[model samples]
Target: MHESFRLRVVETKMSKMSKEMIHLLGNYGHIGFTFVAAIFIGMGGGIYLDQKVFDGRTAPWFTFIGLAFGIAAGFKSLFDIIKHQNKEFEDKD
Candidate 1:
């Protein structure tokens, strides 16, 4: 019984530590993921337009513009997410 009780205490401590680490890491990770995803989406959409828009008429131009727009849109979405998070924090405060 004593051994089991001691094990439980150790497990509880480890769980708390892990939870704190996750909280610390999660915020930074989310930001990094957002930036990477934005660039990827920009490049992907650009390539898609290069392939699908037309054949040599203006495909390359479309691809470049589409990619630029996609990146902008991605950043905008990230900004919105940050704003929402801030609002939540403010509400809590």
Candidate 2:
């Protein structure tokens, strides 16, 4: 009886922890999507400009610049999210 009770307690704790992890994963997914969207938008804009303004140059300078901008934007967004989460934790404490 005691062993079964202990097993039940452990299972309950595990389930609760798993739920929390799932919640955290959902938050991460949102952040990841934001980062990817920013990158794609930047790249798309660059490609459009390169084709229209640059006359489809082989160099792809605009594309490179756009990629850099996109990465920067993504990092900035990630940092902002982390900072906000940290603040929330601090507030909770």
In terms of lDDT, the best-performing candidate is: 2
Clash pairs, candidate 2, are none
Model 1 regions lying over 4 Å from their true place: 1-21
Q: What does candidate 1 score in Cα RMSD to the true structure?
A: 3.2
- lDDT tens per residue, model 2, 1-93: 999999999999998979768867866768979999989988887888899877898448888888889889999999988987788679879
lDDT of 1 by residue, 1-93 (tens): 999999999999998989657855665457767877887888777776677656456667866886687778778877877787688679879
TM-score of 2: 0.66
Deviation (Å) of 27 in candidate 1: 3.1
All-Cα superposition RMSD per candidate: 3.2, 5.3
- Local distance difference test, each candidate: 0.75, 0.85
Q: What is the lDDT of residue 48 in candidate 2?
A: 80
Q: Give each model's clash number.
A: 0, 0
Displacement of the residue 15 alpha carbon in candidate 1, Å: 8.4
